[model samples]
Target: MASSTIIVMGVSGSGKTTVAEGLARRLDVPLAEADDFHPPANVAKMSAGTPLTDEDRAPWLDALGAWLAERDLAGGGGVMTCSALKRRYRDRLRAASPDVFFVHLTGDFDLIERRMRERKGHFMKAGLLRSQFADLEPLQPDEHGVAIDIGPAPDELVERAAEAVQRA
Candidate 1:
């Protein structure tokens, strides 16, 4: 079974980063925040409460792909936190590394919005929650991914994700 490279995907407030970091730590792999791969233009647009088009996301996704490829070639892996809101976005990631897997954090919109509103020091503001949900396409059955509800405790979520990865 493939033992390397996982993408943690969800909308703005679904704990993608937290789960990714936790998984990376548990797996003893590096972790990457896909937000860091975003270009300045995308960040500026989001900061202005604007939703990014597919064009705006292509380069950022490509960068993520490159990072994954690099890590895989090094015979190690990393957990990357990416919104991966669309099917095409996930496809791009899979294309870069066929073995790449995704952990999809799922949660209720109300809960997510509430969390987003209370969160601070995050580039994605609460104002963009609706747009993010609108753009998100749940992982398809054929996709190399697993979905976990965030209704559980952080430790439970991480444990479930780790188990899923082990089985994947």
Candidate 2:
């Protein structure tokens, strides 16, 4: 089997990190958190409860693309977390690494909002959730990915994601 890059994506509070960490462990690959790739300005803006514009995201996406490219060139697989709220963003990633696959974690607004509100020390505020949802585009039919509901526990969700990745 070819090495595969798995991008665990979703809006804030949708369990991207948790799922990605689990998948990384299950797949025995390194885990990259997209938040760490953000520029300080982006982090400050998000911390101030401002949603990032495309302009603000360009360099960040490029950095992530570079990471994917590095993995691809090395012929290794890994998992990463990203908001990837728009098709264009995912497209950028796919352009960098053709074999990239996505695991989109989704849940109801109320559930996500509660989670965000309870999360501490995270730069993303609950107020920004609406903007995230507004910008989100679900994975299209042509996309190589899986959409898993966020209702399950972390372990179960990882199991499902692992199974899905195998199938893909």
Candidate 3:
């Protein structure tokens, strides 16, 4: 099978990391957390309950793009997590790795908020959930991806996502 870079995307509390990790493990590929690619300033801002503007995300997106590009060039599959809240951001990722696929995790606001509150040691505060949802633009008809409801167990979600990617 041809190697494809898979981006597990959603708002902070939507279980992107957990799902991505499972997918990566199942696929036997490297996993990259988009949060780790953020610069200190961006992390600090998010930690302080501030939403990141497009400008603030530019460099971070570029870093993620580079990571995907590298994986593509090496003919290695991988999974990564990102908010990817806008069409433009996803476009940038596609530009970097044309074969990149997205698995969009989504859930109700209340459920997401509760998950965010329960998470510990994360830089993103629960207060930023509103901003994330406000900025999110769901995958469009033309996008190459799947949108999976984040209501199932993590293992089940990974299975669903893996099946979707296989179909893609």
* Cα shift from native, residue 119, model 2 (Å): 1.0
Tens-digit lDDT string for candidate 1 (1-168): 235899999999999888988999999999999998899999999998888988898889899999999988987888899998899888898889878988999999999999898889888889899988888899999998899999998889999999999998
Question: What is the lDDT for 79 in model 3?
Answer: 93
Q: Give the Å error, residue 63, model 2.
A: 0.4
Candidate 2 per-residue lDDT, tens place, 1-168, comes to 127888999999999999999989888888899999999999999999999999999999999999988888887788989999999999999999888999999999999999999989999999999999999999999999989999989999999999999998
lDDT string, candidate 3, 1-168, tens digits: 227999999999899999999999889999999999999999999989889889999999999999999999989888999999999999999999988999999999999999989989998999888988889999999999999999999999999999999999
- Worst lDDT run of 10 residues, candidate 2, spans 1-10
lDDT of each: 0.90, 0.93, 0.93
Give the higher-lDDT candidate: 1 or 2.
2
